[model samples]
Target: MNEQDVYDAIVTRRSTRNYKPTPVEPQKLARIIDAGRYAPSGGNSQTNRFFVVQKQEIIADLIKLVEEAFSKMDVYDGMYRSLRNSILRSKEGGYLFCYNAPVLVVVANKKDYGNNMADCAVAIENMMVEANALDLGSCWINQLRWLNEEPTLLEYMRKLGLPEDERVYGAAIFGYPATEDGKPNRVPLPRTGVDVVYL
Candidate 1:
């Protein structure tokens, strides 16, 4: 790809919440995961593990567990807006954190690592950009990470191969778009709040 293509992918990538049931192509999925693995890691630790979940049964179970966990929580004043929204929707039932995407790439890192979250974040961003380049829709899912320490979730994750010394830091859902054109929305949202000061 050319420079302009890379820039366009970076700018046009958006958080895709709705996705088609069609699974992502294996080649494209491999490339997307490769991009994530190529992301720079702090001190070259390179300990981030990727869990690519594509089984419908497993995904369904995860969604159910997440909803159950959130539903049992009590909303409070000054709570994070997205967390509050999650809790409310979960209580109402049928809250799909991955938006029913066919594939969810869960990024995990050493629980005690100082740069765990940062490393996982960089990987996720790389994967999202790659997904956009491949014409695949992707969304960052945070509910698992938010409940990383919950016993129910931890047990489930362990069954899914999550190591005892590791915790989920981030996740990205991937699949084809459900739009009429079968393409992800590419229109860039205007940014007005990011300030920059040249050193």
Candidate 2:
């Protein structure tokens, strides 16, 4: 790969909310997951666990459970905007957290690990970039991580193979874009907030 190709992938990757029901190709999916696995980890622990969910029934159940959990909670005045929206829509009935994507790669790590979230975040970013390179649409799903300790969600997660000592830190949902041309939008969103300092 050319040097500019990596930079291009990083710049053009965008959060994809709408996805087609079409399943991702097995080879492409494998390569994306591989990118995630190759991400750096604290002390080279490489302990992050990835759970790739592709079963429609299980995905539907997860959506229903997450919606039910969020709907039962009360929103506060200073809550984060995206989370607030989730709580509101969940109460309104249907709330597909994964946007109906065919594949949801749930990342988990030891709860007591100091760098769990950071490690998971790096992995997710790597996977997202790889997904974009493969012409797949991908989005980071945070609702599961927010409710990582909730009883109902924990129960379901355990059933799906999450160990007792592990908690979800992040997730990436992947699928083909719903666009007419079947290509993911690669237009880079303008940067207006990040500040850099020179030493």
Candidate 3:
């Protein structure tokens, strides 16, 4: 892909919170996961693991567990606003952080890896771009990563086959967008600056 294509993909990749009840096709989902796996890692370790979850019941159980986990935690100052919102919403009940998307891709990397979060975040961005290219809605879901080290959450994740030496660093929830016309919005907003400098 050229720079324009990449720019288009990045600009059009809006975070979708609302999703249709339909499931994402396995083939398309696989392509997105493949994009994630292709992301670069520190020292070419290539140890990032992408956990693709599609089972509805498992998703529901995870939602409940996540809500309960956040509900019991007291928010401290300087917490990310979104996470604080999640905690408050969970306390009030009914906070589906994933927005009931058909797929939740959890990116995990070795706990000892120095660039774990960086590599995992790149993978998630790749998956999100790929999902947008395939006309699917995608959003970054950070709650799992936030709770990745919690004892209860770690126990539950271990049951799901997360390696003992690995922890979630980022995640993406994806599905068909819940739009009236069944299409994800692709309008790009203006950007200020990334603080580039010319030689």
- Model 3, position 165, has a per-residue lDDT of 98
Q: Write the per-residue lDDT of candidate 3 for residues 36-113, one digit (tens) a residue.
A: 989888899999988899998888988999999999989889998988999999999999999989899888889999
Q: Alpha-carbon error at 173 in model 3, in Å?
A: 0.6
Error of 1 at 37 (Å): 0.5
> Who is ahead in TM-score, 1 or 3?
1
Those runs of model 1 whose alpha carbons end farther than 4 Å from true positions after fitting are none
**C-alpha displacement of 145 in model 3, angstroms?**
0.7
Residue-by-residue lDDT tens digits, candidate 1, 114-174? 9999999999999999999999999899999999999999999999899899999999999
Steric clash pairs (candidate 3): none
Candidate 1 local accuracy as lDDT?
0.94
Best of the two (1, 3) by lDDT: 1
Residues 1-199, candidate 2: write the lDDT tens digits.
6989999888999988888889998999999999999999999989899999999998998999999999998999999999999999999998888998999999999999999999999999999999998999999999999999999989999999999999999999999999999888999888898989999
Positional deviation of 181 in candidate 1, in angstroms? Answer: 0.6
Going through the candidates in the order shown, the clash numbers are 0, 0, 0
Instruction: Give the lDDT of residue 27 in candidate 2.
Output: 97
Provide the clash count, candidate 2: 0
Q: TM-score, each model?
A: 0.98, 0.98, 0.94
* Candidate 2 least-lDDT 10 residues: 182-191
